[model samples]
Target: MLKHTDIWRAIDRLAAQHGFSASGLARRAGLDPTTFNKSKRTTSDGKLRWPSTESISKVLDATGASLSEFVTLVGDGTGTNPLQRVPVIGYAQAGSAGYFDDAGFPAGSGWDELLFPSLGDPHAYALEISGDSMEPVYRDGDTIIVSPAAQIRRNDRVVVRTRGGEVMAKQLIRETATKIELLSINHAHPDRSIPLSDVAWMARIIWASQ
Candidate 1:
């Protein structure tokens, strides 16, 4: 039996693979941004609101993705397609309060998930880099896996959380008794220096897909 919920989930997955939000995909398809939004799936009366064929055709045209691709994206076998699955959250929302708990596990809202090919690390979580700020080293769409419990050392690629709840990924340069210096992968980005006391936690980067 074909499930509407399953199709909805597949739409989300396909959007992520193309590095787009559901709204973003809708706009590209010349439809309203809410076309694929979660709220639009079922109404208050419990009636399913399937996407229109016109909207679907528009999406196909905009994405240049074929019907077979759409089927593969939503098919039952898709999850087993040799990709290492990791919990993914957007970098922009990662720094917000409560996004991660005191123990560094993902917490309250403003996050979405995705699966990627597995790296050897078992404790990996993917963070989508948002801007060109990381540039040559990490592009805007690049997704990086960070292991919170992994051993962190000077000169390692790391994801750092500040006392103020900001999260950033950089190359550790020098760790002194009082402060830590981090090198930005992009020459255009300035290096950062933070007092040891202001760092909440630091995690090691296990893998990254640019």
Candidate 2:
């Protein structure tokens, strides 16, 4: 029998493959952004929550993915190449101490897990968007996959953390030996230029559910 986690993992992978987070997938399907969030996977009383067939049907319409394809994603997911199972957390909690190592990998507990098509990254993790700080592009409740081990490049989407424990997801504009420039994904937030010394670490955002 297909477990609840297995079904959810398939939905997450499906969203990721189509450049969406679970919330984005929900939005695309005309559902509330939080419909697919991990926090909704269970009830306040601790009972398992399953995705409604209506929501799943909406997602299928939005992604143009057949039920068979979703089934393929939910299967062993270990055929020719094994899927990479990545840890996940909400972006609001990303700056909390002990959730990440000095190198920016998921370290402590409080993380959920999801399977993704191989990205060859052992340090890859997902962060769920919490607010509209990155609106238009990344709205509230969208999820993004970050690869700490991946190369940081100009013009790439990135997640940057400051020594002060601030975490931001933005577009990389320029990076020099002394400082880096970043463009805001949300137009309302002005661009930023911070000294390299102020940065704890910067990781490339390989994928996002938009």
Candidate 3:
């Protein structure tokens, strides 16, 4: 006996547990930052504005929660609790070096941890994209889940880290002994190829809002 209200309640609880406002959760999931805002939950006519399936999937990935955990969160029937604050950084800023220490962890102030159902794996991060540079494929303000431990395969979407300490997300077109080819999602941008030696590290993109 599933109801739309139950889903909404689950989302609300997840947001609270992560110490994010409903809108904040929505933003982290790469949907419209206002999609889950309290004001947007109810329509102008006062009817409930349900969240979409796509949005739910993105939220799950962002929080590292399995679908089963989401169901329990929804059915817990307990009142929403406040979320614990953790450091959050935008996708553009996360690309820069020094933001993370030598151990590849977030550093410095203004950081807060987002709570999600335990997934056993501890190395996960959230990245928010900006601008239409990668549009039609990844829209502005979309949040992406990056797992550094995930294996990278050809044609997989990945976040590439260069020797210069820059990060860019693109599709891996091909890999050879000497170079790597990357395809840009936005047609406006041309594909790129670089020597394998220049690459520092790459993380596969498991999920994205767009």
Which structure among the candidates has the greatest lDDT? 2
lDDT of 1: 0.74
Query: Could you tell me the TM-score of candidate 1?
Result: 0.55
Per-residue lDDT over 1-210 for candidate 1, one digit per residue giving the tens place of the 0 to 100 score: 235765676677778888899999999889999999888998989898766545666777788886446655654554553334467888977788877777676775444555543344544678988988777667888777787877788789998899898788889999999999999877777899999999887888865544
Candidate 2 CA-lDDT value:
0.82
| Model 3 per-residue lDDT at 59 | 91
Candidate 2 per-residue lDDT, tens place, 49-151, comes to 8786667768988999975467567645656535667788889678888778888888876568776656668889999988877887777876788998788
- Clashing residue pairs for model 2: 20-209, 21-209
Ten-residue segment with the worst summed lDDT in candidate 1? Answer: 75-84
Please report how far candidate 1 places residue 21 from its true position, in Å: 37
Tell me the tens digit of each residue's lDDT in model 3 across 89-110. Answer: 6877876877766434566776
The TM-scores, one per candidate, come to: 0.55, 0.66, 0.57
How many Å off is the CA of 200 in candidate 3?
Answer: 1.7
Best by TM-score: 2
What pairs collide in candidate 3?
A: 19-83, 30-143, 86-111, 86-112, 86-113, 87-111, 87-112, 87-113
> What are the runs in model 2 whose C-alpha is more than 4 Å off?
1-78
